[model samples]
Target: MSNQVCAPALAIRRCCSDDVHHMLPLMRQLRYPTTPSVLKERLTMLEGHEQLCSLVAEVDGVVVGTIFLKQHQTHDMMKPVTSITALVVDEKHRGTGIGKRLLLEAETWGKERGSSQMFVSVAGDNNITSKSFYEYSGFTCTGYRLSKPLA
Candidate 1:
């Protein structure tokens, strides 16, 4: 048989607590609402879950990006779906394939864990770059969010 293979452009791995420090700056740069303490807490929670996948993209011993996928327990007419959250890449490394790598890793993890669909929440008009990125990455815009202040 001929050798046919698929390889990622960057190294992707499951993230550990040790990666929190490196990931913090990237998270902040992406304007995620998680503080360091909150991040640490979330990591701890993930460590205890069998259904959560936290992945990191690395280059030469440095962590450049992260993605988190959690399988939702809620069933939509008895069908399962996974929620993808907190995809972050350093600003300097944004378009260099790191984010994409992290996303692919997370999707693979979710698919392997029995999820048929992936979902992410994007701020309606605030994150143009992220909207473009998700669309470019092959996710269709399937929903919307609307809110009004309770004053």
Candidate 2:
């Protein structure tokens, strides 16, 4: 006999202001540290933006993952592109397909908005796990993302 524990049902939906408390820790896990108030403000701002799509994955009413996508048109691009600004799955649920589901939802959201391509920026060069996951999900590294801080 095979004995395998089943994972709880996952629910992915547009993030709302009330989700700040639940999403804060996930954001911290992704290296974005902020207070609940600040996170609430950010979530409110995202809610007011027409080009932004923020989604959260919930399991048994607890937020376990989130993805933030933005749609924009560049000077060089003929069609709008959807950029994945943030994606994080709780450490305990990392390998259970939450991230992938969130990503797929983001893609659907983008496509519904007429976006022709999807893009994501990985912060560090050595983040092999993230790179591998994206690659496995059909994303290819296109170019380097360089940043310079302003004084």
Quote each prediction's TM-score: 0.81, 0.92
lDDT of 2 by residue, 74-118 (tens): 999888999999899999999998999999999999899889999
The positional error of residue 12 in candidate 2, measured at the CA in angstroms, is 0.4
Going through the candidates in the order shown, the clash numbers are: 0, 0
* Predicted candidate 1 versus true structure: per-residue lDDT over 4-111, tens digit per residue: 886545678888776778878987776677777788877877775887878888876688888888887674536567888678887777888887878787778777
Top model by TM-score, which number? 2
Residue 150, model 1: Cα distance from true site in angstroms: 9.9
